[model samples]
Target: MDPIEAAIEEIKSLPHDQSFTFSEIARKHGVVRSTLIRRYKAITEPRTVKAVKQHALTPDQEIELVAWINRQNEKRLPPLRRLVQNWASEIAGKPIGESWVGGFLDRHQDELIAKWTKGMDRDRHQADSWHKYKRYFDFWHAKMEQYSIEPRHMYNMDEKGLMLGITNRSQRVFTRRMWEKGELRSVLRDGSREWGDYPCHYL
Candidate 1:
């Protein structure tokens, strides 16, 4: 807004009591507080505040901007966005430019993401097949009836730990952008590992 016109408007609104707000000027006359301050150089600052660099974001302001971006993308109420902008400006420790508030997401587009939730891989556990052994049960029942044999008279025989010497090998996978600056490691076979490699070997 033109400064000369804003000065005239504020002068007209001035009553016997010279108490008003800068926000009132901004809304009523479409004039920013800085323009009026420039016009009326002798205006007393209402609050005690140290002068701060304009448009430069403080560490706290940066975090508020990030929060604003997330809230805007969340499809929330209009008041939420305005609250975020207000919070961001206050957190900046100075009057922040409107462009800085609006352009935060655009300027940091790569950093802000519209993710609904944390990405996760869902795993479905499937059970392996089990045998009913219906035919085997029938055969055993028939033999018992034919020979009048009891289950107590039967002998059980099976090999235990037949695959004890056999080993299963597994491979490790890495997909990071950068790894340690060293040799590329490959998964070795299980047989390559030995119990005797331990320093404390016992007889």
Candidate 2:
């Protein structure tokens, strides 16, 4: 079951007495009280669908955007942020700005990441051809298997240029240390072990 649905069930299972507030239900179900309240209202006011707040893009529209982005990426042709903003404006039939882009990015952060790429970077100057990358990957995988090389033994360092024109968001500090043989090495991002960092580290 969905976590939200489970939370709804938990709220329903609670005693009818007003003694237990939404906070109590939230704590019991490990969900935010605000989320619980929203779900409760949703359940009790099913007819009030129009009152629900929604993002500018409908769910289907967002899915279409996701597909378009993925297709662009598969062709090694990433769309610029400004291009996305223009697309949004075209869809809405009005000029949208950076604020809309920022909110859209925030809502879809789990499915996408914001990366800073140098405009003059030669690494991505040419669009990657499928056959070329496939050949490279096949050779790389064969070499890895022959040497029993594991991903943990590999590390990549890429320098990201600081955008002088834009304001910095937050500072990131990276510390490195060599580990002894047979010792487990741990890596973290944002000063804590986050599962999201695993994919970035391996890549």
Candidate 3:
């Protein structure tokens, strides 16, 4: 049975006593007192009330779009925002822009997640395939025992870019002296003056 219908029936089943108020019944049945009263009245009046506003896409059509997105995810190739917008426009029989897409996503936030994928160079991504990494790790682990190699010897290197300050030229920072000593404060060097190499060791 529908939950609302079931709740209405449960409310009716309560003892006909003044102690069992509408608030108590509604709370026990997991519904608002106003909603329970409305449903109760609708039961006797036999008239329907329009509850929700019209949506751009019907619930079934939205579910179909969500299914398509899940299918794309299963294939490990999610569609781009533009592709989704075009698809929605095709289904909607109108030009759907970013604003419409955003609203649609907001409406169906429970079934979808917005993600920003990091940009990767095509050549680098191709060389970093899962199968290649698996093979390399398998070989490395197999030779570990023969070479008496410990986990500390294994390491990975990553390179990243850093942005310097707004101006390229160095600037002096003014500060109050403790005792007016002739010696000035230590120079604050810019850490982004050159490329940095980070070593990640595995243990």
- Every model: Cα RMSD to truth: 21.1, 16.4, 18.0
What local distance difference test score does each model get? 0.43, 0.52, 0.53
Question: What TM-score would you give candidate 2 relative to the actual structure?
Answer: 0.36
Write one digit per residue (lDDT tens) for candidate 3, span 79-143.
55666777777777777676666776776666565544333334334545567778977988877
Residue pairs that clash (backbone atoms under 3 angstroms), model 3: none
Scored against the true structure, residue 199 in model 1 reaches a CA lDDT of 49
Highest TM-score model number: 2
In model 2, what are the clashing residue pairs, if there are any? none
Best by lDDT, which number? 3
- Worst 10 contiguous positions by lDDT, candidate 3: 171-180
- Sort by TM-score, top down from the best: 2, 3, 1
How much is the lDDT of residue 99 in candidate 2? 75
Q: Quick one: ranking by lDDT, best first? A: 3, 2, 1
lDDT of 2 by residue, 95-154 (tens): 877777777776666554444432322233232356666896798787778778796875
